[model samples]
Target: MSDFFLNIVEDEPQALSPEKVWKVAVIDDEESVHQATKLALANTHIMGRKLEFLNAYSAKDGLALLSAHSDIAVVLLDVVMETPEAGLGLAKAIRHDLRNFHTQIILRTGQPGYAPEESVITDYEVNDYKTKSELTRTKLFSAVYTAVRAYQNLTSLAAGREGLRKIIDSASTLFQERSIAKFSEGALEQINALFNINSDGIFCVSSAPKNPSPELAQYLTQHKHVDLSEVDNDFRVIATSTGYRDLFGVPLQQIPKKEVRQLINRALTTKSHVIEDHHIALYLDTPSTWQACIYLHSQQDITDKVDHEILKVFASNIALGLENTKFLTQLADTAYKDDVTSCYNRNGLMERAIPEVIDSNDHAVLYLLDIDYFHEITEALGFEYGNRVLNSFADKLKDAFPSDAMIARMHSDVFAVIVPGHGQPPIKRLIEHCSNQPLILENGDALRLGVTIGLSIHQEGTQADTTPESLIRHAEVALNKSKEQRRGSATTYDESLDAGSLERLNLLSELRRALSSNELELYVQPQVDISQQCKVVGMEVLLRWHHPILGNISPGVFVPLAERSGLAYELDLYVLRHSCSLVRQHPDLPPVSINLSAMSLDRGELLDDFASIMERFHITTKQISLEVTEGCLIKGNSALTNLQRLSDAGWDIHLDDFGSGYSSLNYLLRLPISTVKIDRLFILELKKTQHAATLLTGIIGIILNIGKRVVVEGIETQDQNDFVANAGAEVVQGFLHYRPVPFLSFVDEYKSH
Candidate 1:
């Protein structure tokens, strides 16, 4: 062995005083054989265990002795005693007959002629074979010591293998416990898998008295029944009823004492052993809040280097796993939760919440809310600011819904909430809240923001299904119906609303082909210069669609339909180019003003697209007037900028259908324009509503004062015409003169007139 190994073996203190020496067996029949074996092995020591010799004159006597004391490890036997193979027989008998597996048997021979060296070792089951003359003092001690060491290795390997098997089995058993009740029961099984040194009731205690009340954070060495104790804050005796006092032979030292404190402080700061005792191994972590110690029984001396590594790894994995489980659980909770709104995001609603709502047995009142004119806010403020608005709106929605209610963000500007055991009253309250809450921007701009809400009550046994998605669709239908009412109110979905939505869909599809099929025809109504004595100065182009099957559809229905379907730009371009062409073909016709939808005003392609079409028909910009409604200009600076771009591109800009939109005056002054065509609503009650007449007069005066022309639309009677003329309006265009006609009919009328 190396010097290091020799030092380790020598440093091991004696666990017990020199008691009854380990007995040795000598089995030989020769008269001097007994004396020779005793003389060779007498007063010998191997691994700190002394030797006491015992002689057996025959195989029978040795077997008898082995049966009495089963702990004998080494035996010296002579082979050529009674027969030439007596020792081999005795060795085999000891193995099979007595079953002394732990005993190491050695064979000794006096005559080499009877038992050859190689043959005896291979044939005999003894540990070693030696000639009687060569059995000297040192060689005999080496053989006995080598045999004892082999026996110790076998014992330790067997114990280690058995302990590992028990540990795996314990871990498997703990994995199967179904409830918390079995956790404490399984704890004993896990601890029992650890190697036990002696019969001290599975643990040991210190002799020193445990200072009952120690100072804060002082290390304590005491008998603790449970190492993983949360309730026992101080040190206490473990299993006192079992045998704490009897096994320890001394009381334990109390924690928080000055000596214990110093030990703890030293343990935390240094890498060396802070407490060297027979009971436990102490370790303190200064970088963290916890402290720990491992108890080692006196009989279980720490020999292997692997023990400390195992304990440290086990401790770290346990702590990390506990913390990881907690962190993951909290993270999962917040993942489904929306912090600002206290509602679910779309993913949570679709995956988790919808299943819950479906399982509910009670009737659910579902409301789908969409902010009316939300695009205006996004256009006025930036999108980032608009997101803040939406977040704030979501918070209000959460407040409006009950605590147990389910709410979700459905779309960009849409939200959905469900209330149990409630119906229209709650939906009405939500609508009122939406309408009443004025959105306050960061710039101190307050807007009376309103939302159109759709409500549907899904109860059992109804014709409609109560699935979450279906309920949302029903609510969306109601929202469309409410929007048609134009009051920012709540509406319930019904069969009629479904049918109306389908009809609108059909119309939208047909309208897609209306312009391409040449089904739409433009008709001009002359605006007479009554102030210039009935002379025609400008004509308003009124749109008329003649379906091949359905005869003349009103502009009011198809016009708005076309605007929403993105086809109004085509119709406006057609009217502007065709009207200008007609005026160029007939020089007597004045500048024709065609009514344009708000969508056309927003298109950057409007002016250039129109000029290209006019150039195709060989017409100048002065031949046609591009007219946009007051609603177009009311959309803020984008409308004004586009109008100014068109005017700068040499197209006449007229504010057509004036006095129809809210805040029209503000836009009228701001937009670039050449004329104002007063809406028929302002002129319909011109004689009946005196205030309408005064408003018209004031509007006309405002237009003329700005050096712009004023065309009073819907003049159906001479009296209406005379009323407008008397009010100093320069032009008049209405059905009293002519309704919209086909281009060929207008051509014939112009040629004949």
Candidate 2:
């Protein structure tokens, strides 16, 4: 059966010139009608192309043919084909369902009553509607010719739009290339897209001259492109398309084709384009003494003057584009690279070097190094010596690491290096070498320095998308740990080291929500007068956070985080305003004391905000007392000035957490504080040993002798209370006297009394 089918296929006729024919589909139910149509248009030709008719017997066959051939230019349809309106239905399927809007449809019907011409043209989107009786040979020829012309225009517009889109996409890609070679290749691709041609080409660049302009010199210095001018001034192929790819990087004189070389030399000498019958060459000059040329080959002869003009414009633009790319490259280098150490700067390491290293290697380790006690060196010696030490250390880094390794100066006295794999032996050797060698200054002074190193390794076979920023941050965290535990040692990053940071971030976010949502409240713990039969002298206001998701966040955890995050100032303001409003509402309550953050003293506007809040609530400075830590007194003259302003404004100041940090007795005389609260640590130790009582007694006696009211805190036991009461403490604050309570509860218990 297969042999018989092959024999039948061999007997069929073949087209004379298939490539030069325009496809036309003829759909009808009668065989005679198909033969009649073909015979009538047998000698027909339009736009120098002959018609090749495709015959389909029924609507089903016609739809199948339309679906199989998307390039069909026109369709001639009979209205009644096995159904009353089969041809109209097929037209709708072609126009709507298949979305083949490019193909023109000409509907021909024998009976006008079956499907009206006006209805079919308007509803089915057919190009033309004609009755069979009116379609003679002359009219049929005109109808098909008109339809084919419309299809041609539609396809032409679509092709033009596609070409324009490709050009736009290529231009975007060309601007992102960093090197001349890459830029040349991108320009070649875009030029081919613009002309809708796939011809072969070659891009060549001549060497630049020595001692370029100052602008070019600055660019070259920043980008490290000075080596380009060192080579001999000869033209070399930088990029090529398809057949000419083997010519890349080859000198012009060594090219095998003498004719191509002669054409290139002619264009270079004249500094003008050479247009030929089947080829074109363009010459371009850059801002420097460098020149570039492009040679393109085509099969057809050059014609259209518009195309020639566009080619010239494109060439000029290519020259401008090259200069713009050079400027941008230099700008990027200056932004990210450090000129002093010839290493990547902080921006360069994060944006360029780190990404390249991660892309090329499977596993790598990042080392964060810092010069220990660098400030002391600068203070003792001069800044000149400090700079010399930094330069010497940078040299040591370059000598120790491989060429492919990324080295950068993160900031002052801090350098970072990224190496492959997770080994410790090389790092140990590097440290020993650095320690043994001392940097000798120009003044003949040898300075010995120590370094702290932190290492973070990205393991193999892990997630591929880990960012360099996160790795650097983790390494810095480890470096901080090294500095705290052992100043001159190295530590590797671990997941456990990130717990505190992660928790702090989560708590900060929750604290912000708490402040905005009114979840923060003040709890007051009363301070009793021990000599006045345990009378309630005053109440200390404490901050409390009630979070919806994490429940109550302890003041100990969130307060320090708030201070470090700079949110302590806002929290302090909130406490001040709310406490003052409460005291104003219930005048019978004792004087309230609120603790201020040490960070608030550094801010120049703290006093102003405090005064504004007090005036807004119609409360006086005497009604509220501010408690500041001992650390604030020794910060600077600014803190002292702020405190003196508060004291002059009739506000009472009390020293809080005394003797905890830098416990200098000088603060008692220097600060304008009316009361002192001994640190809880000293109060807890009063009953533990004999030295504790003697020390506590002596400290309380000294404060009383100085005429400053002393308040002993953290009295949990009766013995502790009795000792403090007899030891000359005017007031006591602890669980033994009263625990902290909410504002409403405190008002109900004490204010009603």
CA lDDT scores, all candidates in order: 0.62, 0.77
Give every collision pair in model 2.
none
User: Which structure among the candidates has the greatest TM-score?
Assistant: 2
Candidate 1 lDDT by residue in tens digits, 1-753: 100000001111244457746667888887687887677776776546788888888877877888887777678887866677777878877877876665777778887545545644544445677787766765576567656644443333333345344443344344233222232233323433454433222111211222222411122222223223332233232221133334222223343234433453454346233324333333422112333222333444434423554443333322222222222233334445564455676655655576576576467687778887787778887778777787778767767777767787776777777777553345556677777877665566666668888887778777777777677778888987787777578898887888988888888777767766766777777677777767767667777887878787888998877775677887787677667666777866667777777788787776678778887888877877788777786655666688898888888888777777664565556667877888888778876888987888887888888788788888889888888887889788888776666666776876686
Clashes of 2: 0
- Give the per-residue Cα lDDT of candidate 2 at 435: 70
Going through the candidates in the order shown, the clash numbers are: 9, 0
Misplaced by over 4 Å in model 1 are 1-352, 421-425, 437-448, 531-533, 564-566, 573-589, 604-608, 611-618, 689-695
TM-score of each: 0.53, 0.61
Candidate 2 structure lDDT: 0.77
lDDT of 1 at 320: 24
